[model samples]
Each structure stands twice: as C-alpha cells, then as structure tokens.
Target chain A: MTTPVLEARQLIKRFGGLVATDNLSMTVNPGELHAVIGPNGAGKTTLIGQLTGAIRPDGGDIFLHGRRITHMPTFRRSRLGLARSFQITSVFSEMTVLENVALAVQAHSGHSFRFWKPALRDPALREAAEQALDFIGLAPRRDEQVGNLSHGEQRQLEMAMALATKPRILLLDEPMAGMSQEETARMVAILGPLKKSVPILLIEHDMDAVFALADRISVLVYGRIIASGSPDAIRINPEVKAAYLGDDDA
Target chain B: MSMNRATAANMVLIALLLALPPLAGLMDGEFYIILVSRALILAIAAVSLNFILGFGGMVSFGQAAFIGIGAYVVGAGTMHAFEDGIEWLGNGYTQLALTVLFSAVAATVIGAISLRTKGVYFIMITLAFGQMLYFVAVGLEIYGGDDGLSLYQRSEMPGLPDLSDDRVLYYFSLGVLLLFLYLSHRVLHSRFGKVLTGCRLNEQRMAALGFPTYRYRLVAFVIAGVMTGIAGFLLANQTDFISPAMMHWTRSGDLIIMIVLGGIGTVFGPVYGALAFLLLEEFLSGIPVTIAGYRIGEYWQLIFGPVLILIILYARGGIYGFLQPRSNGK
Candidate 1:
C-alpha cells in the first residue's frame, strides 16, 4: 500500500562496450528481505555499486521512498539511511573495535569537528557503538583491535557498523562471503532478526540462507531480472532454472 | 580501551617528555642542548611526514617543499623587513612565525589540489609541485640566488628566557617538540583522526558508510602540510639560513626513509628514526676508519637504506612490528 523503500527502474550501466548492467529493475518494500541471486560476473556487484552511489548507471533512476536519488553521492545516500556492507571485509585494521563502530555513530550523529574535547569520552557515541556491537554479539570483544578479529567476527563487525548508521535500506553484498559453515549459520541467525526491522537487498550465493531468510527472490542472469516471485514460484521458473538456481535447487 | 586508560597514557607520556631534557643535562654536558634542539625540530618535521605516510598511507615526496617554503619565507621576510639594514618586523621571531604560517597556507592549498589523485599518481604530482617550487627558489635572483639567505641572528623567543644560549635554545626546542607531539597525538586520538584512519584503511568502506573519503584525505594532507610547515619554521631559526637545497626530492626521500626506517605506523618510531638518522650521520662522519679509505659520510644514507631493507624484509612492521607482533590475516 505504501511506496517501496527503494526502487530501480530500467537501470543500465555500460563499461566501454560491455553492458555490465542491462535494463535491471527491482523494488524492496518496507521491512522486506529481498534476495537477488546471480552467477558470478552477472553484474550483481555492479548493480549494488550503482544502488549505493559508487557507480552511476547510464540510464534509469533509483528512488528512495518515492523520491529520486539517481545522482546523489555515496555519503549523501548513507546519510539518507542507505547502508551497505562491502563484499570484501574492509575495516580500520589499525583501530580498536570500539573506535570502528564509534566512527559510524559519529557519522550518523552530526559533524565530527569537535576536536577540543576528547571524542573517546563521548558516552553517547560509546553507547551507540555498544548497542550495535551488542546486536551482533561483538560486545565482549569491543576492546580488541579490528585487525585481531576472526574472519567471522570481522564480518559481524561489518554488519554492526552498517547497523550503527541506522539505515532504512541495508544493501548486503554477499554477507556470507568467505564464511565457514558455522559462520554462515551464525550470519543467518543474525540476519533473521534484522530482516524484521529493515528492508534488506541481499546478493547472496548461499542458497540455504536465501531460501530461509529472503521474503521474496529475484533471479538476475546476465544483468537482467529473469524472474521474481515467492520462493516456490522462483524455484519452478524454467528460465531461472536454466540461467541460475538450477544447481542449488536440491 | 576505556577513556580513563587512554587519558592516563597521554598524561604519562607528556610528563615523561617534559622532564627529559633537564635529566639529560644531569647525565653530562655531551647532551649539548643545541643538538637536542636540532633533534627536536627535525622530529617535529618528521612527525608531519608521519601523518601523511603513516596514518593516511599517503607517501608524499613533497614535504621538503613545505620545509623549504617555511625556511625561505622567514629568510626573505627577514631580509625584506631589514631593507637597507633597517629594523624589519621590529622583533625577528614574530616575523618568522608569520612566514611559517604563510608556508602552512601554501602547503594547504597545494595539498588540497594534489590529493585528488591517488597511488603513484599522487606521489608524482606532489613531486612535480615540489620540483616547480624548487625551480622557483632557484630562479629567484634576489635573496642570494643559489647561495642561501642568512639571518644575522636566530629568531628570539620574546617574553621567555633568552633563547640565545645553547642550553636555553635546546630547552625551548624541547618544549616545542613536546608540544607538537602532544598536539599530534591528540589529533590522532580524536574522532577526526579515527575517521581519517578509517578512510586510509578502507576508503571504499568509509565512503559507503557516508564519509566523503576524498575530503577526509585532503584534510589530512593539509594538516600534515601545516605541521611540516611549522617544523620548517624552527629549522630556519636553528640553521639561521634558508636555501632551495632544503626542498630537494632527495630530502623528501630522506624523510620517507626516516619514517620507514623507524617504523611507519608507530607514533614514536619516527622520532626514534630521526634521532637514529642524525646520530648515524654524525657518527659515521666522525668514524676513524673507512673501508678502502673512501669517505662514508654522505654515503651513510646508503648504508641506512640497506639497513632499512633488512628491517623491512625481516620485520614487516619495522621495530614495532617486531615488538607488537600484529596479527595480520586474522
């Protein structure tokens, strides 16, 4: 009944002569977990980049809550409650865990030019960081440097950082990437509760997590959305089976 | 990681540095306060380079330009102020500080423009700008052309103990170095510094999380320039001379070598590096024996390079890397 939280209509991206993204379109409603599955080099990462304002689409518009945000910079998009976890585990390796989340909190709060008073003493920032860390069960290791975190814990820290931005639409590019089976299960559990609160656009290769977590599924092959429906209907779509989802459908 | 511990650490460090010079005198006269002053001043300059190379991960080869700019500004300003041997700036030190400020401003403007490019491009562009400035100094017919401008007197610190005495100047330089170190440490510890570190570590991640990483990097570049500019100020006063020689690319290389030689990421490491570098320079020149009887004086840095390579190859993180044993790929 309400406008989708995010909408991309006829998005087209071309690099040199190669159309990395071709007429791709999707919409995520309020508090919906929409999973986008595609083969490697199918322009999935490129689509995410365009959505988060890293790359510009040659054509089409991206709308956030019915307002066009086609040409906004990445920081502005983030300020507007759009957050994305990088596919690669990118973090301030030299900084402590608290400092990492504290930065995200600082970003969401206001300008950080407050240089005289010590920032580490700001209880508000610390509390906000702790809340995010608590949500991801990373509160125990808050004092440790991020460089010392385990692969799974680092991924959790990434999600915690994104959550600290207080985003409305969370763009997750392969959250389970490089995770062992145990870590993957933990991520699924973590995303389960978050799925109820935020509209998540997930690009995942893990079929089990997608089937368990995604409210709706979109099959992208060769940069085109070939099928979109409930989990069962998407499973039976012949073209989706041929292009993708076939191997994972056990 | 509690705020209390961080504050305590800073307090202790500041206390230790402030008390160090007087204690050095207690040891013996060999700690010539003038040499201490020179060391402290160079450390301040090296700290500025540390901000760019260590924290921001930007390897700038133009810091010497900032140093030269600061030096020449003071030298030229003093000369112009004393036209036909007249009293210029009334008091020389105030004039020198203003010159340093001007150099800081120049560095900021230059850094803001050059930071737009990344990686090797950034290095080359900064080097290009430094070369241009170097040539500008070389081309200046007035103010001693190739020969450096000399001040009749080192800038005097007004309202303080007469800094003309060697020990007094050493103490003053000590105070300045400690102040710069504390300020630098504070800046790096602040939220501003944390975000800058974030930008350096993972710029894409910082951007995606709503930071204009480019703006942050530019701000960092400017801050480093300004800091280096101040060091340049002290240097001119210390040497009582200014020349195009200070701005050479090889000088920039020396600064890089200092930071890398000591350790890149460690805050205190560059200070140690500067001490080691200068001491090595003085010591090697003073060495009684030379292999094949060739002077190893200017070529000391050649030895320093191989030593740095050994450190880099053996200890990836430099001395701190050896001490801390950071868990990479964890």
Candidate 2:
C-alpha cells in the first residue's frame, strides 16, 4: 500500500483521428521494475512520452511520488528525482563522455548560475560525474567524444547521464533495442543491481530481456493495458496472448 | 594537460591585437585605426549573435536591428542633451550610458516578443520586426530620415586621460570588446550554456528531463540581445551617426555571413570573421573593377558574392573550419 513512484490514471492521447495512448492506466511502486510490452504502433512510446511530459495526454493525469506532476516541466520532474533515458539515446556528440555525465551532474548539483568558476575545474561535479560513469562502466571512455562512441557505449553513457541526476525513478524507453546479445547481457547485468534502489518503467520490445529482468509485466495493445501482474501471471493471461504475444511472438 | 597553456596563448593573441592600435600611430595609419575599430565593433555584434544562433540553434537574421536600436538610443540621447546640455560629466557620457542601458531594455522587450515563435516563424518574425524599425527610421523627420543624424559633439569624460583622444577611445573600445569576449566565454562554459546546447540538439529531451526550454531560450535571446546592444552602443560611437540603413535586412545578412564565415559556435570566430569581411571590403574598394573597361566602384559586392560562395562550398567549416582539420569523428 506504499505510494507508487509513478502513477498514471486513465491517460489518453490522440493525433486527430488516431488515438495513440488510449485509456492507459498504470502504477509503479518504489524499487519495482515494471516492463510495458506491446507490439510496434501499440503506443508504448507515446504513453512513455505522456508520462514524461514530452506529450500532454488528452485526458487523465500522471503523478510522481503521490504529487501531481502531469503539468510540470521535464527538468522540474528530473529535479524531483524522475529521470528518463531516451529511446533514441540523446547525448552531446561534440563533448567527451565524462563531460556529458559531468554536465548532467552539474545540472543537478546546485544552481548552475555560477558563471565565474570554470566547470572543468570543479571537483564536486567531476567526482559525481566520474562516479556515475564508473557505475555505467564508461569510466575508461571518459575523455572520448560521445559521437565517437559505439552505439552500445553511447547507450551506457545515456544511462550514466540519467543516473547522474540521482533519480528515485527511471523511465527507460527501449534500452535493449538494436543491441547485440552480448550488449544486452551487459546492460541486464548493470541494470539488475540498479533496480534494487530505484523503480524503473522499462518500455522494451526485447521479450527475452524483459522476461529475464522485469519483476512485473504489463501488456499494452494500441495504448490500453490488457493485463498487469507478475511475470508468470502476465505470460498466462489469455487477453495478453491473444492481443500481443501470439504464436510467432513477433 | 594544463588549462593555463590555452589561457597563455589567448593572452599572447590579445597582446598582439592590443599593440596594433598603438602601431597605427607609429605608422601614421589613421585609416588602419578606423578599419580595426569598425571590425572590432561589428565583431562584438556578431559574437553576440553567435550565442543564440551558433550555440542555441536560433538562426536569426535580424541582429542588425539591435545595433540599430543602440544607434538610435545614442542619437536620441544626444538630441535630448542638445536642447538642455549637462553640468557634471557632460551630455555625451550620459548619452552613451543611456544608449547602452536603453538598448538592453529595448532588446529585452523585443526578445520577449520574438522568442515565442520558432523555426521559420521565428526567422520571419525577427525579419519583420527589423523591417518595422527600418520603416520607423525612414519615417522619422526629426532625425535624418534616409540620411542619419550626425552627432553635434563627440562623447566626453569628466576625468583624467581626456576621452577626446582617438587612441584613448580605441583602447577603451578594445578593452570593452575583450571584456565582452571574456564574459561570453564564461556564459558558454556555464551549466546554463550546456543546457542551452542540449536544447539546441534535442529540446524534447531537455524538456522531458525537466527544463522548460521556452524559458531558457527566451533568457538566451535576451542575453544575446543585451550583448549585441552593447556592440550597437559602440557602433554609434564609432559612426557618430544614426540612420535606417543600420537596421536593413542586408546588414543582418552580413552579420549572419560574418558568423558563418568565421565559424559558427566557435569562440572568437566572429572576431576573425568581422576582420576578414572588413579587410575584404577594403581590398575590394581599392581595386576599381572595370569589366570590359567600364568602371564599377560601388558594384564591388558582386565580386564578393563569388568569394563567399566559394568559401561556403569548399570551406564548410568556415575560416576557423579551414584552419582545423576535419577528422569526421563526430
């Protein structure tokens, strides 16, 4: 009965004629890894966008830590310990990996209005950034530009950037998409321990990864949740099997 | 590994530029002094534009409007003083300060209105606002209409070193420009600057993270305006005149060209660009182009067009771009 870290109630989003996220309602308790699984065009990303304030829902509300945050700006949400790792993996291409994390840490550490102190020389910001990189296993690529990094490394850096904000909840959109099995295994290994501290709302298409990692699974078909339960219950749900996980499992 | 090396190099560069104005006196090159002054003033304006256009991804084409605003403030302040001259610091210093302060306020007001729109709308709206000022300047009968208002007297300082000296003014202007450059660099390296860059790259992502990008962008626009407004103040002092020609869209285009030619988003790039642009103008002005023996003195812009096109085509990185090798890593 603890207050959920993220709670979405009857969220609806539309694009003129198309209903993207239709009547989707969900909740994530603290430290719970909740996976939202749906086929392509099932509005999972749209739902995620609505939750993260990138797109406003037509109807309903989203609350973070029992607070009405649906109308809040993204940075305010992040300042309040809600961080979202982009599905597309956004990072400063011209900057070093360490600089990327350092900037993120700096963004959250205190008032960024300090204009005199050169950011590169700041020890506190650097330490926090270094620690975040260390956690994401990108400490070695600290000086390398994010643009020069491999896709996997960029994804890791994205995670590090998100973690640097020191969030109570992490919203990840398809973290395992377009990754090799080896990369996925590494991500799973890294994420497994982090989930112990922070609640995660993972929207991933990778079923194998989802099955292996997610504590609870929710089935979304064209924006509506068909079922929500423990992994075993979700796998056996008839509505989920018929609507999403068919025989071929595409 | 030490940051001091970069700072040391910058200091050396600053010294070289600082020594140039003094050498103009030794060489008896008043025109050279004038040329460098114009370049520095324009560079100040262009550098300010780079903050919004280069760093913030706001491709503005009406920066000249701010310069125009500054010119008017100076002209109007001086006009007001002529009717009722001053007692203490004289009318001119008060006029100059009024111009700078009012130019900043005007820029803030304009930016508040203009930053609401984005993309092509932003571009067109800024252009429209600049053109609005252009018409207003043209219509003003109190000033000079097509012809700019001439200053009755140069700005005065009430203290030691007497501000009437040309070399003194040059040094003062140079000091101001360097101060601006330092402040600009500080802003770019700030956390606010990083987020601004982030907004440029992916505003949606920045918004999702928690920052209201519109407010940030508006603040950037205002900051850029104030910076450019300072340049405008210097510009009026340099010219000792004010006209509608200052806000013309072509002038704005020239500012854009300066940013691109120097290297957008690079520190001190606009300074190099403004100097190059003015030098090219000077070089072209000296050569009277007579195609098939027909004289063309004012038609030098035609020749400059081809050169700019060549630069755009070959040196995509601009002037600084040409200096730096492209590794294509990013």
Candidate 3:
C-alpha cells in the first residue's frame, strides 16, 4: 500500500465547551476521492478548517505525505501541495478571471518578489492560468471580472484557482453549495478527471454526488466519524443511517 | 474608455505642472511658483500615503511622522552646521541618506507593531505613534522645541543644480514628484504588486493561496514611509524650517483627506488632490466677501466643509472618478 497522501491522526479541536473535532482520524491515499458526509452542524467545517490550517486542533496531529504539518501556517500548508476552495465561493472580485487564476499559478511558480515584469504578461503564469481555466471550463470568460461572473461560474473559477496551485491533495469545501443542478453536473465532470491526477478530501452535503464520486466515504457526526468505508459499505452501515442518513435514504 | 480618459487627464496635469515655472514667470506671478512647489512636495506625501491606504488597505495615520523624520534630518543637520560647526551634516548626500535610513527604521518598528492589529486599532496605534514623534520633537529644546528649527542654509547638493534659486527648487520638486509617480506605476503592475493588491481585496483568500500577506503589507508600509521621508526632505528644504507640527495628527488626517479628494486608488489622484486642496485653501481663505456684515474669509471652513462634502458625495471615486466614471464590469 502506498503511503497515504494526507492523514489526520486523532485530531481534537474545542471551541469553549463544544468539541468541534473529537479524536477524529482519517486518511486519503494516492489518487483517491475521499468524500466526507454529515448533517448540518456536524463539525465538517471545523474538520476542513483544521486540515487547511485555519483552525488549530486542540490535540493530535495532521500529516501531508507522512510529514507532520499540524502547526504550519495556512500558506505554508498550501505551499506543501495542499489547496482548498471556500464553501462560500471566495475569489478576487475586482480582478479578471485570468488574473485570479494567475495569482495561484504565481504562488507555485516561485516567490512573487519579482517587482518589474507584470504577472499578467508573463507567459508561464498566463499559460498555466489559461490551462487551469480551460480545464475548469471558464476559458471563454477568462477576461471578464470575477465579480461579474455568475454564481456558478465564480465557483468554477475557485476550482480553477485551486487547481492552478497543482496540489498533491485538494480539500474542497462544498464546491457545489449554491450551484444549480446543471452546475453541479458540470462540477462533477471536472472533478471526475481531477481525482485521477490529485487525491481529493471532499467535504460535501450532496448525497447523490457523494455516492457517485467517492471511492470511500467517511460519515462524521458531532465531530466524530461513526464509520469510514467503501461507498457501498457506508450506504449499508446501520450506525451511519442512525446518526446521519435518514430511513428513506437507507 | 475610462482608462484612456484617466490617462489623458494625467497627461494634461503633468503638462501643466511641467509648464508652471515658465508660465508663472511670463505672468509675473513668481510667488505662484513657490506655492505650486509646496503643493508638489505635499503631493509626494499624499502619493506615499495612498500606496498603503488606497492600494494596500493599510490606513497609516502616522505617515506625517515619516515626513517629520525627513524634515528633521535636514533641520538637525543644518542646526549642527551653524551652531556646532559640523559642516558634514549639512551636505545633501548625508541628509538624503539619513532621511531614508531613519524613515525606514521608524516605519519598520512602527509597522511591525501596528500591523499586528486591524481596522480601528491599526488607525489608533499609528496615530499614537505619530503623536509620540510629535511630543519627542516638542521636547527637544535645543532644536527649538515648540518654536521650530530654522535652517541657516539648505543642504548643498555637490553635483546637482543649486536649490538656492526658488525656480530651481520648484523644478527639482516637480522632477522628484514625476520620478515617484513613475516608480509607483511600475510597482503597481509588478508581480509583487499583484500579491499586494490581492491582499487588499481579500487577505484571507490570499493566504489560503500561499502568500504571506502580513509580510507583504509590512513591506508596503516601509516603502511608503521611505518615499514620504524623501518628500519630507524636499519639504524642509522648500520651507527652510522644521517643527513638531509637521507630524501633528491633524496633518495625517489631512493626508488621508487629500487621497480621498483626489481619488483614493488612482495613480494621479494624489497629485490632483494636493493641488486642489492647496488651491481651495488659498481661494476660500482669500474670498473678500463681507456677507451679513461678517468677514467670510476668516470663517472659510464654513464654506470649505460643504464643498468637500459635495465632492465626496457626488464623486463616487473622488475627483478622478468624477473625471471618468469607471466603466463597470471591466
């Protein structure tokens, strides 16, 4: 078995008395799409926060490629091939779509201390940004301002930016959260091939999308995982049905 | 289309500034040259402030402290030359070097502390630092304390044109202003500038993308301080005096106002703002009207305050936006 590309070992995070993440452990192996599903207020957001270095875990550790990164800064984590898209569609609104993706590309190319040549005009940055946008199917709107893009398109731009970082593992926080059915289908298409290139630890509430795309699904309930297994196995898990999935779905 | 309009206005403004000395001479308005030069020097300060405030989203209220630092560098050097018989301190090279060094040091220290806070706390802490400098200047009795220091001689530029002539000084100020404006243009388009701007738009997002935004903002703050310090160097030479009032908190407020009035983030906005502010001050204060048997000029702020309100209210992006409304969704 290959070493897991990303791992969370007994992670613990507390907000006052509420345990946001409680001894939660998980792993994503090479080229696997691992989806995490849970009901609202089940600590999914908190879990992603810890993975992305936005929240400090109260105890335990996280490792990227078997290297401990629990205490690293968010940017350092990103530099180490971890990229995340916000659940609420965060993009640079004032900048053009291409420029937005180019910034992510710039982050990976080298240090951005080069203070003379325009980043937009740089061939390497532009080509990589364009390729990411093309892959996310936003190539036609690359010149438009991100603020002017439709809600679904902005989410796609977010994906393009995350992809431009060329991450070893991607942490997507509800990339489909406010997207339409057609938009969701479009995103699934993008993610279908994306998982083949980089492993994904997806936190999403869309049940159908989860079952269709997840190689393995982890059911989180009140900060603890009740079960983690193959999508079909998770579907049959009685505890998951009791804690999260309702009787109709079961 | 709006970009072109802004570019045209910038070109016209620069042309007018370039032609001012000769034009003033023809009109026998020699005093106008000095007044415009003072505006140019202050414009440099405004541009520096805009770098952090408008672009980097770091509203530093202590900018006047850097200007004060630069001015005092010259003032102290000249004082030593006349009283202590230390001529080396009076050289332009030494004064310029000291201004850059001291301003960089002061900005680094202040920014390192101030950048730790955000929003109102940042503003207050910067204001506090400015007042700290102001008080320090007030306490120095040997350098005139509250009265201010008078420069017996301007710093001697060994290889450059003499600044003793008022016309030469005015042109010098114009040249420096042009240089800084160009430098700002270059920086705002650079790769580093893209990161700085991204931090301004959404810092958390920038960090998620792997840019250390705090370090970027700190560097921008220091750059602004060093530039404003150079303006302060020119300012002391322009006025032939330096005092605690140079770094007064109100002076910082005035710099922010200038940025807002001209157009906050636009490249030429500060120059437009500085010139407009000084022109307004001169025009409003000299209004020879006696309305209701009361001299209107003495209480010009009554009228001045409303004019600014109107500009801010109607001009969406300040005066530059007024000149060319930003084409939406570019």
Candidate 4:
C-alpha cells in the first residue's frame, strides 16, 4: 500500500486528570478523505490539535509522508505541507480576504524577511492569493475585510487560507460547525474535488457530510478510536453503533 | 477614499514639519526652533514605540529604556573621548551608528525575555526592565550617577554641516525623523509587516500557518528599539546632558500616551500625538491655573488631565482619528 500521507501512533494527551486523547492511532492514505466522528468533548478536537502540532502529545509519535514530525512546531509542520483550519474560524479579521490568503501563500513561498517591497504589490503572491480566493468563490469580496464576511464565508476563507499553503494533507476541525444546510452543501462540493489532490483528516460532528465524503471513517469515543474502516463497514459495525451511533442511522 | 484622505493629511503634516525651522526663524528666533526640534525628536521615539505597541500589539512600556540606551552610548562615548583628550570619537556619525547598534542588541535581549509573556504580564515585565535600566544608570558613578553626565562638547561630524548651530541641528533632526518615517512606512507595507500584524491579531493562527512569530516579533522589537535609540542620540545632542531621568518609567508612560493620543496604529499618528502633547504641555505651563479663585502655580497637569480624559472618552481613535472623516473604514 502507498505510504499514508499522515500517520499517528499511540498518541496520548492529558489535561490535568483527564486524558484528552488516549492512545489514539490513525492514518490517512494518499488521496483519501478520513473523517473522525465523535460526540462533543469526545477528544476529536484534541486529536486534531496533536496531529497539527498545536497540542503536544504526552507520548507517541506522528509522521508526515513517512517522516517523523511528532515534536515539530506548527509552522514547520505547515511548511512541510501539513495545513490545518481551526475549529473556530481563524482568519486575520482586520485584513482583507485576499490579504489573509496572501499571508498563507507568503508563509510557504519563501522567508518573509523582505522588508522593502510592499507585500500587496508582489505579483506572484497576489496571483496565488487571487487564485485561492477564486477557487473558494470569494474573489468578488476579495477586498472586503475578513471580519465583515459571514460566518459561512469566513469558514470558506479559512479553507482558502489552508489551501493557499499548497499542503500535502489538510487537517480540518469542524469546518461546517456553524454553516447552514445550503452552506454545508456548498462546502461539501468544495471539499469533494479537493480530496483527489490532497488527503484530508476531517473531524466533524455532521454525520451526513462525513459519510458522504469520507472514504474511510474512524469512530472515536472517550478519546479512543473504537472502530476504523470504510463508511459502509462502520455503518454496520455493531460495536461502533453501541458505542457511538446509538442505534441511529448515521 | 479614506486612505487618500489619510495620505493627504500625512503629506500636509510632513510639509509643515519640513517648513518649521525656516518658518520659526522668521517668527520667533532660536527658542522656537529648539522647542520644535525637541518635539520632533520625541516624535521619532513615539513612532518607534508605535511599531511594537500599535502595530504588533506589544505594549512595551520600557521603550524609554532604548532611548536612554542611545543617549548613554553617546554619553559614554563622549566621556571616554573627554578623558582621553580626543577631539571626538571618529566623528558624531560613528557615535550615532554605535548608539544604534547598542540599542538593537539591548532590545534583542530585553524583547526575547519580554515577548515570552502576554498582555499585562508583558507590560509589567517591560516596565520592570525599564526601571532596572534606570537604576543602573543611576548607579553608574563613572557616568555621573543621578547627577548626570554633561557633554563638554557635542560630537563633531566632518563633511556635513556643523551640528553646533541650532538651525543646523533642527534641520538634521527633521531629516532623520523623515528618513525613519519613510523607512517605517515601507516596512509597514512589507511582508514582514504583514506577519507582524498577523501575529498581533492571532499569533496562534500565524504560527499554525508556518510563521515563527516569536522571531518576527523579536526582530520588530529590536528595530523599534534601534530607531528609538537613534532618537535618544539626538536627545543627548539637543540637551547636552544624559542622566537616569532619560529612562524613567514616567518617561515611558509619556511615550505610550503620545502614541495613544495620535492614534496608536497609524503611521503619522504618533507624530501628531507628540506635537499635541508637547505643545499642550508648553501652553499649559505658561498659563497660571486657579481653582475656585485659589491660585495653583504651574500645575498644568490638573487641566491636562481632564482634557486628556475627555479626549480619550470621546475620541476612541485619538486626535488623528478625530481629524479623519468618520466614514473611513479601519
């Protein structure tokens, strides 16, 4: 099998007395969309935090493209093509939409120590930023401040920023948390074509979007992965249903 | 449209500043020129503080420490020269360059430690460092301690106009202020500025996006320190004296007030702030104050305090913000 784009082995994280992420192990193969589904406070976000280097694991290891990156800083991980979107929409609100994406492009383009030339006037960076905005259908509002964008639009901009970095893998934490049904559909459409190019590790509570897009799904409960397999197999897995789905058709 | 208005206002301010020395000569004589030059020097210091405080959201209360560092470099350099009976230490230009270098190095060390904390802790720690430097200045018996060191002679700069003349010194200070302003403008619009602003807005987000924000912030902090230190070099030349008073905590507080009064983040806001603050102090001090017919002598702060409070309460964007068209978006 092809090497997984991202791999976590026995990841552990604790917050005081509670183990937030307990011995969690997961992988996303190249070109695959792997969804991690769990109830609220089930350590889904914590797991993503560890994967993206925001939260250091108490024990275990993480690898990116078969290279160890367990202790890498968040920025280094991003430079290595491990991009992530926050569960909370985190865009530079004071900056324009294009500026927000341009910053992401600038992050990976080269050292940002260039202090003389105006960043907005840089042709290459501008072109890439414009492309990312165009891809996300936010081109019309490119000059508008990100703070003024709707919650859904801000989510799209967050994704645009992640994509602007040209990551080999994407880690999205609840990208559809506050979106309306139509917005969620639009987001799903946006992610559907993206999976062919970059592997995704999506932590989501929305089962419909997860089942539709996830090539494989991992059911996490109480910080442990109770089951991991194709969506159909997880749908029929009795253990997963009892532990998480609760007899409901997920 | 707002950007154009802001640019026009800035241009007008610059034109006035450039025209000041010649205009002051025609009107009042040397005193006015010296007063305005002092204002300009302090403006540079305020602008430098704005980089870390306004733009980077690092409310460094110890900025006066950098200014003091610059002044002390000049003081120490001159003291060594006087003791050795040398006319000047390779000219004033070399002294100024040394001051800048020392200030940058000092800022790097202070910033590395201060940037580790956030919000109020950062402010307090920086204030502590500033006070520490102030005490050190006071303890330096070789440099006159609290009595302060008096420069027997201003450092000489060959090939350029003599700085001994008040008019020449005023113009030189104005030139340096404008140059630093231009450089700062370029930096604010650059990629480095973007990252600095990004870190200010959301450091975690910037870090997640592949930016080593700590290093970026430290670089910015050092740049600000060096710029302010240059202001200090000018301050020493303007007053011909250096003392621990230069780095006093109240002096740093005054710098913070200058930035806030002008409009914290705007490029030329601090300049306007320094001008307003110094002019207000000058105007207020000249007038006698009375409370309910009881005379209060030279307590200008009583009136200044109320007026500043009113300005802060009503004008959230500061005096610069008050001057701009209200519809202009941030």
Number of the top-ranking candidate, with DockQ as the measure: 4
lDDT by residue (B1-330, candidate 4, tens digit) is 345767888889889877887887788767788888899999999999998888899999999999899888888888888787654562698788898888988899999999999999999999999999999999999999999999866768888888878888888988888888888788888999899899889999998899999999999999999999999998988888999999999999999999988888878889999999999988888776577885554788888998889878898888888767534444
| Candidate 1 lDDT over residue span B23-79, tens digit each | 767987545455656767778778888887887788888888888877776677667
Q: In candidate 2, how many Å is residue B310 off? A: 1.4
After superposing candidate 4 on the true structure, give the runs of residues whose Cα lies further than 4 Å from its correct spot.
A247-249, B1-3, B292-297, B325-330
Considering DockQ, which of the candidate structures 1 and 4 is the better prediction for this target? 4
Interface RMSD of each: 2.5, 2.4, 1.3, 0.9
Q: Which is superior by DockQ, 1 or 2?
A: 1
Model 2's CAPRI class is medium
Instruction: Supply DockQ values for each candidate.
Output: 0.52, 0.51, 0.75, 0.83
Which CAPRI quality tier does the interface of model 4 achieve? high
Of 2 and 4, the candidate ranking higher by TM-score: 4
Q: Between which residue pairs do clashes occur in model 1?
A: none
Counted clashes in each candidate structure: 0, 6, 0, 1
Interface RMSD of 1: 2.5
**Model 3, range A132-230, lDDT digits (tens) per residue?**
998989999999978789999999999999999999899999999889999999999878888988999999888888888999999999999989999
Sort all candidates by TM-score, best to worst: 3, 4, 2, 1
Question: Counting only residues 3 or more apart in sequence or on different chains, how many pairs clash (N, Cα, C under 3 Å) in candidate 2?
Answer: 6
Which consecutive 10 residues in model 3 chain B have the weakest lDDT in total? B321-330
